[model samples]
Target: MDLQDQLKNLFPDHEPEESTDKIDAKPSYWLQDDPIICKYEKRKGKPITILEGYNGADSDLKKLAKDLKTFLGVGGSVKKETIIIQGDFRDKIMAFLKDNGFTVKRVGG
Candidate 1:
């Protein structure tokens, strides 16, 4: 007999319980009321994008940073709650954040 058949024969009176794990598997992150600042700067003649003003757990912010980097196919790092992207991706990053339910504020050129 198959595994399911064996299980049914052994626990004929047992009722299958609904899985609650799905409810807890949803990804959750802290949401802030203030918009996250997206700024552009030139360091050593190379353009870099900076995201700051996020008031949340550093781990969540780091996950966000990694997601952004992977989505944009670029390199970045997180320091002191600030996300530093290697290129000037202010527009793209802001759009991605907004699509993911985040408030983004563009600051400076």
Candidate 2:
């Protein structure tokens, strides 16, 4: 018999309790009302995209940065409260953030 069968034999009248761990495991992040700024700039003659104004946990911001970099197939880093992406992908990043329920404000060309 399997583990379930053994368990049933050991306690035939036992009723399993609903697990709340699954519900708690769901990822959640703070949603800010103010728009997140997406700015484009040239650093050391290389184009870069900067994202700032996130008023959430640093871990959440880091996760966001990772997701963005992975989705865009680009390199990036999270410094304190800012995300620096190694490209001029302002439009794409903005759309992605908007889709993820973030208000994005485009800054600088």
Candidate 3:
């Protein structure tokens, strides 16, 4: 027998509780009404992408930053409620955020 068989034998009259979890659950990070600003800038002569205007918790913003970096296969960081990606990726970042249910606004070229 398997582990399930042994557990059933041990608790013959116990009923299994139904799980309330969802398989396709959305992201736990808070989504805001205001559009996230996706802007590009040349910081110290190096191109960088900045994402700001998030009204959620700092942890949520950090998680978003991490996700963005991972999804884009690039390096980035969360600073002062803003995400700083180490490249010009406005179009890709905006598309990714839109697919994930976020409203993104492109601020600059």
Candidate 4:
């Protein structure tokens, strides 16, 4: 099943949180639905990863982008509930979230 479908089946009451894109030394941890992390297609093959969800808002998502970028020392952004980071940071991403108290699982790779 697709990420969204799996997430819906996993948590029916899942809600969209908010991200402000601020640079916080301590990022928030979230056990959210499926997050879409794919290499960005544009920018001359820059290793960009895009993370999207069924829920989550611009502010919270922006926060995610900022935190991940700083953590991985890469570039990224957040828009329309999507957080895009420039790099294949799947392993680091999952570990970072978990280390900060967020439950996570690798959906695909």
Candidate 5:
């Protein structure tokens, strides 16, 4: 079963009810521009990929990361809302973001 199905099975009374758009769905004053940040760090002297700047809920970020990982054919994770893949893909990610209509600016060196 899927995660949502599993959750519903665990808590039958709390089954999800499809409703109107969430308050956050609108362009609000509190929302940050959603963009994927790509960075490389050392992990025990090994290079590691860190994709950050995902500003959303846990499940939503996780789902986005999962889809991205599948498309990139790389192993990655959704950590604290950051999508950490296994390699540096700043150019690739920037292209993806642009194709999706998200304005992007590469921040770090």
Candidate 6:
């Protein structure tokens, strides 16, 4: 006999309980009211994109930084809650953040 048949034979009156836990379809992070600032700058003669003004947990910010780096296929880091991307990708970054339910404010050219 199969396992299910054995179990049914052992517990004839027992009924399986339905699962009540709800799983979120997508992962969500703390979204702040203030828009995240996306700016461009040249540091040591290399163009870089900086995203700042995030008023959320540092871990979330770091996760965001890691996601951005992977999405853009570039190197970056998070320092003091600010995300520093290795290239000038303000427009793309802003669009990605907006799509992920974060307000983005583009600053400087």
Task: Please provide TM-scores, in order, for all candidate models, with all chains considered together.
Answer: 0.74, 0.74, 0.75, 0.54, 0.58, 0.75
> What do the candidate models score in CA lDDT, each in turn?
0.89, 0.90, 0.89, 0.65, 0.66, 0.90
Write one digit per residue (lDDT tens) for candidate 6, span 1-109: 9998999999999998999999985457888899999999999999999999998988888888888898899999998879999988988999899888999989986
- The superposed Cα distance between candidate 3 and the true structure at residue 39, in angstroms, equals 0.3
Report the CA-based lDDT of candidate 5 relative to the real structure: 0.66
lDDT digits (tens) for residues 52-76 of candidate 2: 9999998899998898998899999
lDDT per residue (tens digit) for residues 1-109 in model 5: 8988889888989956798766753222222576556677767776556767767677666766676677678888776767777777777766765665555567567
Return the lDDT, model 1, position 59: 90
Q: What is the C-alpha lDDT profile of model 3 across 1-109, one tens digit per residue?
A: 9988999999999889999986974466688899999999998999999998999988888888888898899998888889999999999999988988899999965
Each candidate structure's count of clashing pairs: 0, 0, 0, 9, 0, 0
Clashing pairs in 2: none
* Model 1 lDDT per residue over 5-105, tens place: 89999999988898866565324668889999999999999999999999998899998988889889999899888999999888899988887778999
**Model 1 CA deviation exceeding 4 Å by range:** 1-27
lDDT of 6: 0.90
lDDT of 2 at 22: 55
Who is ahead in lDDT, 2 or 4? Answer: 2
Higher lDDT: candidate 3 or 5? 3
- Residue pairs that clash (backbone atoms under 3 angstroms), model 5: none
